[model samples]
Target: MKTLDFWFDTVSPYAYLAFERLPQALEGISYSVRYRPLLFGALLKHWGQLGPAEFEPKRAWTLRQVHWQARELGVELALPAQHPFNPLALQRLALACGDVDGLPNRRVVEALFHHVWRGGGADASDPARLQALQAELRPALDPQGGEVKQRLRALTEEAIALGLFGVPTIAFEGKLFWGLDALPMLRAAMLGDAWFDGPWNEVARPQPGVRRR
Candidate 1:
């Protein structure tokens, strides 16, 4: 059986959208889904890319699109009061919870998604709320847990190495499909379809010696 790496960041609205539908979308499929918790902030920093919230216009448009897409998909979604809350603890908690290839980790994913996106509290970043979550999940997650933090960092670095620049990316058999919009394409690739056999377009190859300007 093949395994697909699902790289996600808890604070990402798009990730939340994918989280809601991924299971059903993947139903009857032969792939094993492994939920990997990674830091989107770190990726942005590494690539020197601006986050959606850092640019006001894109942020507004993206949020609107998110709502529309959620409704179109019939998935319940709500934006947190804070757009880019700290994701360190969330990632760590996920690591502490163990593998999400099964039921227990699924619940943790849903609960964290709800806590940050659907719930109006926007308290997932609050230390008190984090403690409450840690207590409730009973996952042996210490907010200051060292090993879990390292694990999360390692996963984020692994994502970078895998050529990932965003959340909700699915990596299967060395092929990467990014964003919820790419899910269908990913499914096709997973099913051994011919759509993936040829080049879709041509672009310039990266010149490492030349500076990007």
Candidate 2:
């Protein structure tokens, strides 16, 4: 079976949106999905490439763009006051849960995303807060929902070894699709056997003629 390797961090809001929709997008497609969790911020540091919103101008533009895109896509999102929070533990937990059938741990991931963007879950750095979150959801913070901490840790380390440095990176048949905007392309690739052979198969090609302004 074709495999869709999904790489993401728990704190990534866009990743959250994608996670909520991907399975439906892949329903008719022939493929197996795999999750590879990693540290979002840490990965960026290793590549010398900062995130999309590191600058003032970009940040301002991004907020507007995010709002516009969210409206069009029907997913609401905003940078919460509690942003840049530590999502290491959450990612570890997600990595573990990624393997279980039906992704039972997705509820927690979805909840964390909503908690961060929809409300005040952004300030959830305190361990007690996570514990409380756990008590409210699954029993004792893991594995009950098919959550696996140890494997997630290994997967994060594996991602580091694979030279990965971004959240929402999907590797299909050795091709990597990074970022949310790439989701459509990913869906197209996923649904088609000619994913690597289509006329517009420029996903991995070099377009030197297309100049960047």
Point to the candidate with the largest TM-score: 1
- Pick by lDDT: which candidate is best? 1
RMSD (Cα, Å) of model 1 = 3.0
Q: Once model 2 is optimally superposed onto the true structure by TM-score, how far is the C-alpha of residue 7 displaced, in angstroms?
A: 1.2
Model 1 clash pairs?
none
Q: Write the per-residue lDDT of candidate 1 for residues 93-167, one digit (tens) a residue.
A: 877887543222668888888878777646668878787887878785554678777887788898999889988
Candidate 2 per-residue lDDT over residues 124-171, each given as its tens digit: 556776666655555433542334555555666777777677878888
Model 1: lDDT equals: 0.79
C-alpha positional error of residue 166 in candidate 1 after TM-score superposition, expressed in Å: 0.7
Question: How far out, in Å, is residue 37 in model 2?
Answer: 2.0
